[model samples]
Target chain A: MTKESKKDGGVNPRDEAKERLENFALKVLESVNQIEPPKISIPSRSTSNIVFDEKERYYTISGKTVTRTSANMRQVKKFAQTMCAADFCKDLIESKKTATLREMYYISEGWETGGFADQGRSDRIVEDLESTFGVKREDLGLLPEEDGASIFGDIVIDEGGMEVKATKVGRAGYTIPPTMSDVEFVECGADCVLAVETMGMYHRLIQEEAWKKFDALVVALKGQPARATRRFLKRANKELDLPVYLFTDGDPFGFHIAMVVISGSAQLAYINHELAVPEAQFIGVTASDIENYDLPTDKLRESDVQRLKQLLKDPRYSDDIWQSEIKKMLNLNKKAEQQAFSKYGLEYVVDKYLPEKLT
Target chain B: MTKESKKDGGVNPRDEAKERLENFALKVLESVNQIEPPKISIPSRSTSNIVFDEKERYYTISGKTVTRTSANMRQVKKFAQTMCAADFCKDLIESKKTATLREMYYISEGWETGGFADQGRSDRIVEDLESTFGVKREDLGLLPEEDGASIFGDIVIDEGGMEVKATKVGRAGYTIPPTMSDVEFVECGADCVLAVETMGMYHRLIQEEAWKKFDALVVALKGQPARATRRFLKRANKELDLPVYLFTDGDPFGFHIAMVVISGSAQLAYINHELAVPEAQFIGVTASDIENYDLPTDKLRESDVQRLKQLLKDPRYSDDIWQSEIKKMLNLNKKAEQQAFSKYGLEYVVDKYLPEKLT
Candidate 1:
């Protein structure tokens, strides 16, 4: 859903979009116009190429390789395809039109003719371009659409002449853009952010005026947070320097979603720094919280047991909080979704759970 | 395996192949020359468009609608591509070359430009052309080479000056072409055809001189009978009027293979008359044969159990023999492979099992 822009006075992005495209093209032309063989540098997304920095509390791509003409002809196809996609993506941004990953694939197919076998090759090339530029595809105005997140907060943002007040939208809320670098956050009043896993729980809190009462912004992740939701939450945590907390189902998927938000997803491992909210904490529906709140038991699904068993083996969940909480869940053989808190009464979540957890 | 010529006197097929190619191209040119909208008829392989005839004992394409330039523009593209493929196959035949289904798909993709989505669409169109022409792709000289079935019989045929006598090839046998319309079987001395499911049993019987002793022709199916095996067996049954017996393990896959040979596979359902051996008898290693032969029991694998359970529910397995045999297998939770017959003695299958079962 589109929201009214909060900053009608913000700078127009059309000129900025053109400038970004021109700069990307200039880099390519500069390399091509070189006296020596062109060497393009790119960060490797392969796990072997990523390093965990405990001091910085985040992971970063370590292997920065410069592509040059060598005896190994293996990189020839990849290098040509990456350069082709980069040139194409710049054209997309300059034309002021967004292309889905699928559209970009078809465009590549048309450009390369018989060179491309299928969409998979094109998708990899797009990723190579993203890693090379140190930016997300959405930042280049390419989008898949319909999977961005919903946010209701005391924040103001403008797109073109449209002014959107996130807090005033009430229960409906505003959709976070797939790429928020273009969106200007004119004002920020929320003290913290509560990222809820389910829309049902988010609405209940909204109906109760939980955000206004607790002075926190509420985000409904819908299930596992989409790439846009994670990006938005990461930015909110960093820019406002506000504490971010996650509330999800007391199930394995929920635990993994929370982990993915805090520590980046492996699929998008290359751009982890642009998305992860490392300092974020999960607030509810943790395993122990079920007994403390006397939430009614829902029978554990077969999938829940399987996922819980898996989480126990994962190295990342070796932390004391994750291990103990997961162990408790396994022993209970029951998972409580966030909506289960409604068993304590609709207002109980905002009145009791929030006060107890937050304080 | 190459065999000596049983007959040096046979028709040369280069002229025949050339004639077929000229006729195909002329038909396309005639369509182009037509003053009005030209029409093309194809036997649609869609299950919904198929009609099962119990009386005639075969399935036929129901719709007789010729593809023209009216509303259903769907057939126009398919018709053009199919004609294009037929033209390409003729080119392969005339050029004395062969192409696999994958090669054929790439040829279609190159020829039609944007007509195909994948190999699957191209394959279906090829099948349509095959059904329409009443010929196999290999018969049109588009050979995949390795998937063809091998047969050992007192028969001979000549192709492009190469003469092959099935009996002279000895134990190695002659690989049957996908289609036998051009092949000439010069001799048939055997009383019947023994279609053994495994090469082990076929070899054992051949070594024992069982074919000459019992006045029978032996065919080792290797595993599930390929299209070539099914077609050759069907033609032998129809033309030579030879009694055909199928010998397979008392298991689910074995049963399915027997059924495919008896009532053609759904994949080739359009060409049932050219492949199915409905009158063929199932011989040996049945559920009841365990006690008669004192075969040792082997526990059924999980996949075997699943397949057995599925076979019981199939509408076609409603026959009394199939029901009783499968029911017994499910109840026992055991299966006996055909090799189990060797438990009595090395030649027990030929000496005892065959004598008892055939009698």
Candidate 2:
């Protein structure tokens, strides 16, 4: 046989064995697919504990019970593993690169929590994704929270609505996903569901069950939203029946967030018309309130004023009354916080928004 | 043999040798000190042909120049090295503290030209100084030219007469001490001598050759008696016959300089009250100039203002018109530099002071 077919004991022996094993595994996979596939018995929850109820099917994957008809525990594990492996696999396929099989296996398992268990590792992975695939934390709904909970699942609110926040936690956790049950729940019907967001407000919202239920959801977008957040908000309004009201501090970051939500082009993303939500209104902690409330001048930072003035140059936001109010705040060099409204106590908010109060 | 006297070649030989060297060095230093006796030599112009003559008087210790006169530079360098031993030294010291040992040395050498050489090294030294000492650059002043040239000489100009600046540079080639000549010339009844000041100003004036052709000689007295800058003015009035006038800046430094000339202080070796001169009047750049000329705000730093105000509160200086005027300048944050009267190039100053023909 030619050198290709020869399996002599030399430097090429190990390489030949590895190729043989890979080809054998591929053949086995093909045969496994072809052979009458084993019927995966998905566990079903019956109305009565007796006869089989074929109509409503249930299954468990890595201990989580899911109701989706096509779900199988083994299949989900496989899918999770596949998704995890996809990071490396895609990298390999696109770049003609390859990593150890063990690395691929661990990466697949890592996708169960979207790799957030080890924060440092998750952040690194997200960064790699962003740099390599142009994927944003907001796009993956993996953005950070300002306060409370290590992940979106841990964010629990009582009767008082949830506060979603994002700082510089991770790239994945900044933008909120619209597909989250909470976002859908808020979007569906709940009135006065305030989304007290910090930096990563949108990213966390899209992962919750309450996002769909709100009649009027207050979105406190901190700095600005990425393209994904804007896109989600646009899709959310179009597909769901909720109106988004934005509230931010009377500073550059706050002003920019409102502008992003309403008109949609911020520093990085240029999805202006595609992502802009025309109905979203700027609300609360206005520049006019700073003087009217007799706020302390020292509370205002000159850098903050300088930043706000920079945003006023953007034509998309320049004409906005809120932008003008922000400019006035800068000129006066005074700042007032949202809690400052409580200086007048609950009475002030009631008096100001009494007629329009949902409750 | 005793340990002190033994020349041991044993285990401790190195220590013994070191001890011997130390003792020898100490003895040599002591002998050198006895021989030199720490004499303060006033350098003659011919000391060094290549190097400039003026800087020769700066004190040296063991052949090394006393690089700094104040604790400021020492402190700054110490702090900078302690904080962060990075390249920050250059930026911190240079921009923060403009003058360094080399620049000071150059200044002492009569290189009166502005701008610093070896800016990088100077900057590093200043940064090191600031970092170590916490002294800001603005607090220091270069030694005045006249003071540096004279071996401690003083000059005084009387009110309502021609302005005369007596400096050593004017007597560059003169050999006989001006002090003796002035005493002899005044006693002989010179016709053109305008004033007969105390030994101090008279010495400097004669050195400058200004005493040769003046009008009357006014001899200033301490407490209205026989002597000072005022004695010279009175003598000039009697012998050479000329009207007298005075000029000074708008600050405490200038005020005190004038006072020293008119009233002989005990510290100046003119202790007799008989030598006090009471007739001299104050001239322009008074405290009122602060309000009269709408000067820069906060010219007198807040601390300085507070100190001056405290001084004004004192019973001694409070009611004094001159002191109160100084306080007014501090309050209004206005200052008058002699340069402001001319070099500031204000059209009002030119039109008001200079003749129309010159304009």
Model 1 DockQ (Cα-based): 0.01
How well does each candidate superpose onto the true structure, as a TM-score? 0.46, 0.27
Compose the digit string of candidate 2's lDDT tens values, residues B1-359.
Answer: 00111111122322332343344345435745777322111112121211211222111112112222113554433332222222222222223222223323232222222223343444443333322222222222111111001111123322112222222212211111111102111122233322221222223233233434332232212122212233334333333343443334455554544444444333322121222333444443565654555422225666656656655653323336857686567766755532233222222332442222112
Tell me the spans in candidate 1 whose CA falls farther than 4 Å from its real position: A1-39, A64-74, A112-115, A299-303, A313-315, B1-359
**Cα deviation of B188, candidate 1, in Å:** 85
Cα displacement (Å) at residue B312, model 2: 57
Q: In model 1, how large is the Cα lDDT of residue B171?
A: 37
Could you give candidate 1's per-residue lDDT for residues A1-359 as a string of tens digits? Answer: 12232321243434454465467567666767875444466666777777665554556677666553422477666666666666666666665445556445544544553235655777776676667666677766555523456677677765433456665432345655445555665577788889898655665666578888877788888777777687778767776667899988788888988888888766676788878888998887887887887665566788888888888876557689998999999888877767656444446678888888888
Residue-level lDDT tens digits of model 2 in A1-359 = 00111111223322332343344345435646877332222122232222211221111112122222114654554333333433343434343222222223223332443422333554444433332233333333233322111112222111113333221112112223221212322212333324333422222232232234332333434345544355545644555434556655556666666666665443223113445666765664666767666532235677885677676765555456856786787677776544333233223433443223222
Candidate 1 lDDT, tens digit per residue, B89-127? 777666555445644654453464444666678777777
**Per-model C-alpha lDDT, please?**
0.66, 0.35
DockQ of each: 0.01, 0.01
- How displaced is residue A5 in candidate 1, in Å? 13
List ranges where model 2 is wrong by over 4 Å: A1-187, A191-215, A218-232, A265-267, A270-278, A292-299, A320-323, A353-359, B1-359
